[model samples]
Target: MTEEIEQFETVLGFQIPEPLRTVHNVHRWTRLGNSDEESIRSIIARYIEYRRAIGTDDLDLLRTFRNNGNVECIIQYLRQSIRPMVVNTLDNSVVLICQPGGTDFHALASLFTSRQLIMFYAMLGEYFFQQVITQEEISGRESGVTIVYDLENFKITDYLNPYSPIMQIFRIGIALLQEYYLELLRNLLVINSGPIVRVFLQLAKVILLPKAFEKIRIISSSNMKERLLELVSSAALPSAYGGCWTEVDVENVNPLTCCTIRRPIEGKAPPCNIEAAEHVNLSAGKSYSAKISATKGQTLRWIVKTSGKTEFAVTLYDSKGKGEAELLIPRLTIATPLPDKVPEVGSVECKDTGVYGLEFRNVNSSFFSLKIRYGWVLE
Candidate 1:
């Protein structure tokens, strides 16, 4: 070991100076079974100070040693001879509380080179690679430097490159640690546990992506509005829909008054059925040029054709139900129509609003179906 000490300076390209040499001698004596517990503990204290001087932590150094296996035997001797006494053996397992913020896997691994701890180092690597590296090619099962739990389950990541022999050695070492730990780690000390949990949770969110997007696309504003209109139209059919307007209040004013018919009866028919279907919506804004003819006893009927069932009203000028010019039609003028003038329907903005509901007369009676056409400037 002393002969190897001379070569250490040559390999490291720096002389093993005073305090460092003293610490290393004490460290070697313990490994060689020549030092007492007190002397080894003193060496640990001095080694800690030396580490602080170099501005590195245990975790950092361990990772570095793992990357470069040059000091493996020396580090292994330290782990076997000194590290066990330094640990805090808890009820469940050992807890290595790094000095406040001074503890790191690299430094710890560099100091203690036990197989159990080496496997843990691999796990720690796996955990960090899973968290920090999102690139898919770099995070695969066959990746060179790997972290393995069981045979099948492992996180293999690329450390550097295929050309670099240093990286190759590091990868082999990590793989060896993984294989060795599988056989040795009977009681698992959690390695990279936090980041692993986080990765799995993030994967769960990605798995649920399609369903989330479907909900968004279906319920968007434009689609929702169209869906609403379709539903309203479907539910608006006569057998289903009671009426367009709800009767709120009714008021009776005068008995009779002078009334005049306004607007032309513009009509239409749907594409298919023409039997009980000839519908018409009367344009209520303009006066209709209608030709009215009547007789005595041989009842006169002025039929208004429409597309569907509709509500219409009629009013007579200075006449009541049984007056001189009384309305004696098919159903005797349905409801109370406007007296003097009819409410305008077609406007500039909307399509049309006149007398809307019109249909074919079911009975083939010789009632002259008055087909009047009128137009208005849609406002």
Candidate 2:
């Protein structure tokens, strides 16, 4: 309210519309992650510049949202269930939600228009900036948000045709965030999928933008929850989805404040760590390799204990070039005997000694930790 346009005059090095001053809470909450007055002003200026480039004027949205305040039904949607839960991690908080089965998108869109949708995102942006981003910034690291969409019972609907109005509205909402908000979304996780998920993805591939499409992870139901556990702790997830949150969550109970995330669990059992080896985090779509010099025929023995159904390949090569060396062990995706047990081990002799290359690659899109140990011995 303190002459926001004037404050941003020099920060943005451009002229801002005077009508933007009438927007409610427009100036406030802009500095959720910023500490000083200049910092917040700079953030607003950058946002305005980006929006202008993307052909989305926030002034129009703010002007439209100022008139509608009857959000009783929208409030119900926010608190209908323990949804859109924030899972606090080392990097930042991930907004996780279990999509309601058999959704009524049409009725909801009718109740909430584009104006209301704009206000909704504004509120969410403020909350995320204040609660998650600011905290990470204070700790000397840039913050980001990961959104998880649990597609457990998603139904293939005619309402979700390629060019439907509902999908258009959804795309608009996504576009608003992508264009206006910078460096906000870290990743989008889609799990607990079924047959309908394939159809949805097929359609989405054609409609979605390249950046948004790249962020999507269509995980298998077998290892879906396990993949989510890596991004968000098990304590942050619902008990029904291998987390610690119980049926009755009291007012004081919050994953960020009260929930202590220790490890992943299934039903009433402990985590999947069969062999007590050293745990190492595996990055998705990246290959991890280690070189060990082998003299004559030193046997290379290794054992890997994974957390869940993580597809990984173990390859041992004597050299690294077109002329392939003796394949000590061909790359094979390690399979878990059962969903509960995840322990795999293999040993291959190094036929020759010139810098033997041992590579371990994560074949999945989601991150999974591995408890691995290896050694070289005389055979």
Clashes of each: 31, 0
lDDT of 1 at 87: 15
CA lDDT of each prediction against the hidden true structure? 0.26, 0.48
Error of 1 at 151 (Å): 23
Candidate No. with top lDDT: 2
Give the per-residue lDDT of model 2 (tens digit) for 154-254.
Answer: 56565466354346455555555554453455676777667788777876676666666787777677876676677667655666556665545544233
Superposed model 1: Cα runs more than 4 Å off: 1-82, 86-167, 178-181, 186-379
Model 2 compared with the native: what TM-score?
0.46
Best by TM-score: 2
Looking at candidate 2, the ten consecutive residues that score lowest on lDDT are 260-269
TM-score per model over all chains? 0.16, 0.46
Name model 2 segments beyond 4 Å from true: 1-72, 78-85, 98-100, 246-379
